[model samples]
Target: MGARHEERRRQIAEALLAIIDLHGLDAVSLRDVAARAEVSLGAVQHYFRSKDEMLLFALDYISERGTERVRRSLGQGEQPPRAVLRDILAELVPADDQRRAELRIATAFTARSLVSPKLADHLRAGYDSLYDVLVLLIRHAQEADEMPAGLDPERTAAALFALAEGLGMQVLIGHRNPRTALAILDEHLDRLSTTAS
Candidate 1:
């Protein structure tokens, strides 16, 4: 019963994600999501008490999916700090169909976060967690002399993260191609390497 219940919620969330992917975020309605999920409106409401609840689930679902992909990109065994950091940032950009869809949902939520306190809190926490990790990675690299000790970990992490997200947004709006965005990210990483003493 528990498994079935969880599966149903995930199913509805996936429908919501798909809707956000194809239609604008403003087009989202419980009725629309019910139609997309091939379930009754009551079914969605039963699983999620409110629209915000549904949206939160969709965010978590997609975030978990992206995390799984990132873990896979890291692969087995310990990789160099540069390799690990690069893989993490590279996965954040919309370099493939899956990532593009994920980014679409994420971008929509980012806008919606302004008015939805629940979503705003969730998004803020997620960003803070990722930022902390990035800062930690930079610190570790500096400790190992992989990155220059002169560079501040917090500032460098912010810059790299901002660059990756900006590139993802650009790709979504067609201002930049995925390949080009990734190339730019790689070039930035290379510059960091060259700066190391």
Candidate 2:
């Protein structure tokens, strides 16, 4: 019963995402989601009592999907720490149709977060989790001598996260291409390998 309930919620969230992909978030409505999901309007309301509740659930679902994709890409500890970090960071920049759609939704929610404290908190928590993971990866790289010995893990992680996000925005806006953004990230990662002055 629990699994069925969760699956139904996921189906509703996925329908919401599809709607956002095709028509933008502004086009979303309970009736539209119900139609997309092939379910009754009451069913959507049962899972998400309000528009705010539905949007929050959609954001969380997308975030979890992204995290899971990164986990799958990283696999089981075979890759080097720096490589894992690079791959995970690269995932933030959309390189295909699916990723682009995900980015669009994320951008929408981020803008909405500016006016909604609860949404802002959710975004902050997501960033914090990413920052923590990056810091740990940097520490591991330092310990393995893959990165410079004197670099501060936390600061470096923060900078890398900022760079990736900035590059992602640039790519999304067409100010930069995906290849260029990735090359810039690679350059930054290469610099980390050199001894700090």
Candidate 3:
């Protein structure tokens, strides 16, 4: 029963992501998720008391995996400031189908978070953690004089995060080309470098 419960929960999470992927957050409901997962509504209720809770869980799950990826990237090879910066930044961009799906789901959840405390807290935690990574990269750049010392690490980190998320949304919505999104990022980074210097 325990294993079955666990499996049902996994299915529920997968279903939620798929629903968000297809119809966005507004279209997701416990019934929709249950139908998508091929599970009874009661089974989903057993795992998550509400759609909000399930959404939060999915968000946290995505954030945990993303953090691990960023950590692993930073741990590998050379580790030069610029190289690390680019690599870290690259992870945030939705360069592949899987990442694009995640981005789409994240956007849907964020929009739902406006009035839901459960979703808002999850969104806040994810954003804060991702922002911390950006802060670390910006500080590394500062130490190497790749970025200016006087720049506010907080603001700079926020700016970089904004660029990634904004571009991510554009890419997810099919409104922006990946190459052009990258070019936008490069141009933004170039401006930062000049300002930092």
Candidate 4:
């Protein structure tokens, strides 16, 4: 019963995400989610008492998937700092249709957060998690003598996040190419190498 409840909640979340992706977050409602999920409105209500709850669930679902993808790309066991950084950073880039859609959905949710403090809190946590991972990679690099001695992991991670988010927005708005964005990232890493020495 617990597993079935979890599955149903996941389905409703998926349906909410699809609606947000297709019609924008503003168009999403409990009724729309139920209709899309092919579940009753009461079912959505049972799992989520309000539209905010549903949107928050959708945001969390999307963020969890991104985190998992980053973890997978970073691979298991031993790996170099640069390799790990590249893998984790690659998760932020929209390399294909699915990723692009995910990015779009995240962007929409983030924009909505300006008016919704609850959403802002959720995305803030997500951002902090990614920053923590990036900082870990940088600290590892420094310890391994892969990065410069004076480099501040927190600041560098924040800059990388900004670069990734800015480039992602550009990609979503048709102002940038994924290859070019990647090249920019590569150049940033090269600069870090020079600074480390």
Worst 10 contiguous positions by lDDT, candidate 1: 47-56
Quantify all predictions' global Cα lDDT against the true fold. 0.84, 0.87, 0.78, 0.81
Model 1's TM-score against the true structure: 0.86
- Displacement of the residue 90 alpha carbon in candidate 2, Å: 0.8
* TM-score of every model versus the real structure: 0.86, 0.92, 0.75, 0.87
lDDT over C-alpha atoms for residue 62 of model 4: 72
Which lDDT value does model 3 have at 196? 35
Off by over 4 Å in 4: none
User: What's the best-to-worst order under TM-score?
Assistant: 2, 4, 1, 3
Q: What are the runs in model 3 whose C-alpha is more than 4 Å off?
A: 1-12, 23-46, 72-78, 194-197
Q: 4-86, model 2: which lDDT tens digit per residue? A: 88888889988999999999888789999999898999999987776667778887888788878888988887778998899
TM-score (C-alpha) between model 2 and the true structure: 0.92
Could you give candidate 3's per-residue lDDT for residues 1-197 as a string of tens digits?
Answer: 69977677667888878888788776678898889899888987876777677777777666666667867867866576766676667667788876778777677677889988867876888778878878887898889988788888889889888888788788878899777888888888878888833
Please write out the lDDT profile of model 4 over residues 1-197, one tens digit for every residue: 69988889888878887787788867777888899899999998987787667667776777778778866876788888867877777678786777787888788778778999988898898888878989999999889888887998889889887887787778778888888988888888889778834
Top-TM-score structure, candidate number = 2
Steric clash pairs (candidate 1): none
